[model samples]
Target: MKDEEIIELYFKRNERAIEETDVKYGNYLESIANNILNDDLDVEECLNDTYLKTWDKIPPTRPKVFKAFLAKIARELAFDKYRASRSKKRGNGTMHEILDELEECIPASNGVEQSILGQELENIIADYVRSLPEREAFIFLSRYFYADDITAISKKYGISKNNVSVTLSRLRAKLRTRLVKEGYLAS
Candidate 1:
């Protein structure tokens, strides 16, 4: 089914909307959840929560890109689950590694001012990503947004793993420079 049709089903309050959405995006959403959460049971729980969240969101909010909408929900839920699980016992995981990589460029939300600037920071980062070359942007998003590992990104883009690391390092450096210029980070 097309995205519009599925969205209409959602608007009409039909349960089939969730089914069709699952049919179209289950594997993709599962991959996103799995990337952040390597555990199968957590991934399944996150996916179920994602569908429930989507069902509640779509009535009032019709998304422009349905796939991206679902992806965002799934990612957020997965991150939440990952955080909750880690809070019990601190451990190294994919999400932790991803955040460590981005910790240099992205500031922690520690203060009220920083929290207020969160949306602006997001916009700045989005604009910077938009300005990158296609391959660079793909690599950036694959690692950061999708929480993909270096090996996965390297294979997906047909580049050496070392090259992927180098590209990500350079991208992070450039992002830090941009953030500094934008006053999100002190130079």
Candidate 2:
């Protein structure tokens, strides 16, 4: 089914909206959850939560890009699940590794002022990502946004793992420079 049709289903409060959305985006959403949660059971749970959240959200929010809207929901749910599990076990996971990789480039948020800066920082980063070349942007988003591993990225692009690592390193450096120039980071 087309996205508009699915969205219309949502607006009409038809439960088939969830089924059609699953038919279209189930595997994609599973991959996103798997990347962060890294467990079959957790991924399944996260996806269920994602669908529930989507059902609740779409009545009031008609997304421009349905796939991206589902993806964002899945990612956020996966991250929340990961954080809860991590806090219980205090174990390191893919999400932690991904965040650690970007820790230098992104500033830590503290109080109200920092919370406002966080929103601005998101725009700054989004603009910077948009400015990157297509391949670079894909690699950047794969690593950071999708929380994909270096090997997966390298294999997808048919590049050596070392090359992928190097590309990510340089990209982070450039992002750091951009943040500094924007006065979000002290030079």
Candidate 3:
């Protein structure tokens, strides 16, 4: 079923909306959930939660891009699961590693002013990403947004793992410099 049709079903409050969504996006959503969640059971739970959340959201908020909407929900649910699991047992999970890498460019300090600046910082980061070349943007999103494995990303892009790391390192440095210049980071 097309996204519009599926969305209409949701708007109509039909149960078949869930069925059609599963049929169309199950694997895609599962992959996203699995990336953050280490256990298969956790991934399944997050996917189910994503569907329920989607069912609730679509009536009031019709997404322009169904795939991205589903992905964002799946990713958030997966991250919540990951955080809960990590609180019980530390270590193990690509989400931590990905965030650690990003920590370099992001400012560590926080205050009331920082809270107010958050939206501007997000816009700066978004604009920086938009300025990147297509391949760089894809690699960045694949690694960070999707939480994909480094080895998998290397193979997908036909580049060495070291090359991927180097590219990300360079990008992070550029982002850090830009953030500092924009006063989001200390000099």
Candidate lDDT values, in order: 0.94, 0.92, 0.90
Off by over 4 Å in 3: 108-119
Clashing residue pairs, backbone N/CA/C < 3 A, model 3? none
Better of 2 and 3 by TM-score: 2
- How well is each residue in 13-118 modelled by candidate 3, as lDDT tens digits? 9999999999999999999888888789999899899999999898999999999999989998988888798889887657889879999999864688878888
Question: How does model 2 fare in lDDT?
Answer: 0.92
Cα error of candidate 3 at position 56, Å: 1.4
How far in Å is the alpha carbon of 46 misplaced in model 2?
1.0
Lowest summed lDDT across 10 adjacent residues in model 2 is found at: 90-99
Q: Each candidate's root-mean-square deviation in Å?
A: 0.9, 1.2, 1.9
Put down candidate 1 lDDT per residue, 1-187, tens digits, no spaces: 9999999999999999999999999999999999999999999999999999999998899999999999999998998998899899887867888889899989889999999999899899999999999999999999998999999998999999999999999999999999988888888
Best by lDDT: 1
Compare the candidates by TM-score and give the number of the best one: 1
Ordered list by lDDT, greatest first = 1, 2, 3
Off by over 4 Å in 1: none
C-alpha-based local distance difference test score of model 1: 0.94
